[model samples]
Target: MSDQAQSTTMTPPAPSDFDGRRAFGRAARIRTPRTSHAVWSPPADRADPVSLLEEQATSRVPDLVPVRHGRMMVSPFTFYRGAALLMAADLATTPNSGLTVQLCGDAHLSNFGLFGSAERHLVFDINDFDETHPGPFEWDVKRLVASFEIAGRHRGFDDKDRRAIILAAGRAYRERMLAAAESTVLDAWYDHLDVDTMQAWLHDERQAERAAKRQVKTFDAVVAKALTKDSMQAFAKLVTTDGGQMRIIGDPPLIVPVEDLLDDTDIDDPEKAAREILASYRNTLFASARHPLSEYTYVHMARKVVGVGSVGTRAWIVLMRGRDELDPLFLQAKEAQASVLERFLEPCEYDNQGERVVRGQRLMQASSDIFLGWQRVRGEGRIERDFYVRQLHDWKGSLDAEKAVPRGTLLYAWICGETLARAHGRSGDRVEIAAYLGKSDAFEESIAAFAEAYADQNEADYQAFTAAVADGRLRAVHGL
Candidate 1:
């Protein structure tokens, strides 16, 4: 096996006794009853959520920190997306099944999306790994289900509809885990949710309910749009030509070219420094006689602000030209910090934070970007930081929760639940997790209740956040 494969692989030993595994799971209920999952009252000594955000901001780029606050302030759902740290603390107070999984630690609804598989087929899976770490499996489920609840409230969905949507996700997760438990080890490992399968699932839902065909049309439209969102599309949208030299367009705080940032800096030769960093990153990729990345030569780079939670820490878009300018590759080198879950659980195994993300992603994701790699670079103040690199856009697409109708959102929630189960089953004991969940809806109903309670907590936290910004405790530039 390759070194990368060896380092990241965490396959459990072949189960000698399925009944024993299931018994262990069932026994866990005595220690932590299934109904206990519904509880979500904050501890008396709970840390202030706003204070945690302030502490986190100290390590990020100062100027971009407010942008993160601004993005989070958009709505309670948005605030929930950026408050993984706050939620991680709260989840620590809850009861767990003790069935561990390689979690997509920030598995909010927005984090589950569509991306191109290595085979070029578009597949839906967890797309973010900023805080990925092994912990209680239900932690991911609660975060995902609660996102639907919070989002449903944001869209003015009735309480009944919101409860149904949340229940769909919880039920789907339980069913999928049970199914994985019955399957062979290899079968569970090979499972993936491709676009064709996704379309079929949606079609079946529509056929059973005799719902509008527009859902199918929406699925097709999303798939079509995703296929067009490859690197070529990114190049077309982000690159500009100046004096016959292609360069990343400068859009200030959002996208600043390297030259602009290096103007008065101590870095003597900016391009040379950039190339050296690129060369170090290249070594981290799958190295053969000639790696695929070696085909591309470094051209230009820019610092870019990206995503809701990932706004502050340094992120850069590196431009590479393969064959010529027409054939370009855009790689995003995003900083990787200690996971939000780290404080609550055990520390990460990988010393390099970037490797922690890449490895966790490989363990949970059925398919990953080919260009995925990690490197540590010393920048500006000569301080070294870890960053994981991947293609800026590889047929990426996402559902806009704000615009999705109730039926569509419910269907998407089911898919997200199934996707999360497949991910968990890969790394955790499928038989154990499945047995813990059982054939009953006890766990599912409990989680749905927890989602509702957490949504209420999120609204309270959002209020405190906005208050901080209003009183000048936190700076926020709106409408970015």
Candidate 2:
């Protein structure tokens, strides 16, 4: 149909009493559980996973690509985290329910964690949004559940234990989605797993009063640590006063100052570039959030590479000092690219990839960073990139794998599942999702099976990745 004909159809919207419940019933007629997620098998024509990594590397910093490879080479868990593009490609062929939401394109065990909410409370949510976009919600859940299956291998877990964790994560998602569906819109909006609330929830299971008090205190300290870790933390970690003026201490290929990166290019005027780019970022924020930035002045910035998948991305950390020497804030500006899902799904609503991250984050998270914003970089001669900026760390800490006991892993799975459900509920039709999930556990069980099958595929991919590195096709620098 032509555009004018399609417009005419919308002008006379009297399609026999349409409503949300009826719209949801209509979605149920699409994908079925057995065909949707149960059957999982790799195609004969599956693209080489390493080639996908190579394709992604073309857009990243050339030198840092080796670091990304090295990180993925560490273990299957790390490999899964770094191979989001590979998985995205695979998921494109999988059966989707034809429902879309703001997806965390790289959802995995390591990607969900603790961050300070705008109210200064410790909240658990998806902490990364580099590839956030509107796509099938199951893509996020499948990646999340599969992460547990892959990580379990690193911990020397048996198939039964791995299956149990996968089921636990999937069940949590199903149950939470049902709860959100039954809740009032306001309740769903307010739902979040904050530190204090979590502590209270755990209280009933505690034995001794004194021991429980100590545990709560320990949790409090962990949350408080994020507040203390600010610009001074970045200052001490990334720079030092040497030979007259302070400078970002070079940490080889990982932490290269942008000045070293550009030489005597337009970046030679570092302060001027910082001022102009920062103004662009400030304009992206809400008026209230933008005003507070005026209290601080830019001190220094360095290209600080971070995360297994994110190692090669153009990420810069900036330090801004406030009224006094003690008052400092650290902000991160990371490069944004079109989401991996864009190839299979509709194009993103926003033109700027950075805005896609920021807006999608606000829609999914219970609360967002007050300083969250975006900027477009315009250098000489077609040098342009989009970046999203936020505080480097605001009492932010992630659960360590060292502490992943069977009991703790179960709890972590629930936390991740519940948080992910909340994120989807905020942007998706929870009622429809809950209905599709139904009274049975078939959908959850199918995902767990898919997780196991995908875990096997991940191991195979890991082997290929290592072989390429061994043959010198890929360069990997082991250890930091």
Each candidate structure's TM-score, on Cα atoms with residue i matched to residue i, is 0.95, 0.90
- Using TM-score as the measure, the top candidate is 1
Q: How much lDDT does candidate 1 score?
A: 0.88
- How many clashes (backbone atoms < 3 Å, residues ≥3 apart in a chain or on different chains) does model 2 have? 2
lDDT for 256 in candidate 1 is 92
Q: Kindly list the per-residue Cα lDDT of model 1 for residues 1-480, writing each as its tens digit.
A: 111111112233357878888887777677678998998898898899999999999989888999999999999999998999999888887876677889899999999889988888889999999899988899999999999999999999999999999999999999999999999888999999999987886678546573358777888888899889977899999999999899999898899998998753235566887788777777767653477888989889999999999999889899999998779999998999999988777779998899999999989999998888898876577877888999999988889887888888988899899999999999898898888899999998999999999999999999999999999999998888
Q: Candidate 2, TM-score vs. the true structure?
A: 0.90
Steric clash pairs (candidate 2): 226-395, 227-395
Best by lDDT: 1
Candidate 1: stretches off by over 4 Å:
1-14, 204-211, 263-270
State the lDDT of candidate 2 residue by residue for 337-427, as single tens digits. Answer: 8888777677788989999999989999999998999988876665778889999877677766644555556667877998899999898
Check candidate 1 and list the clashing pairs.
Answer: none
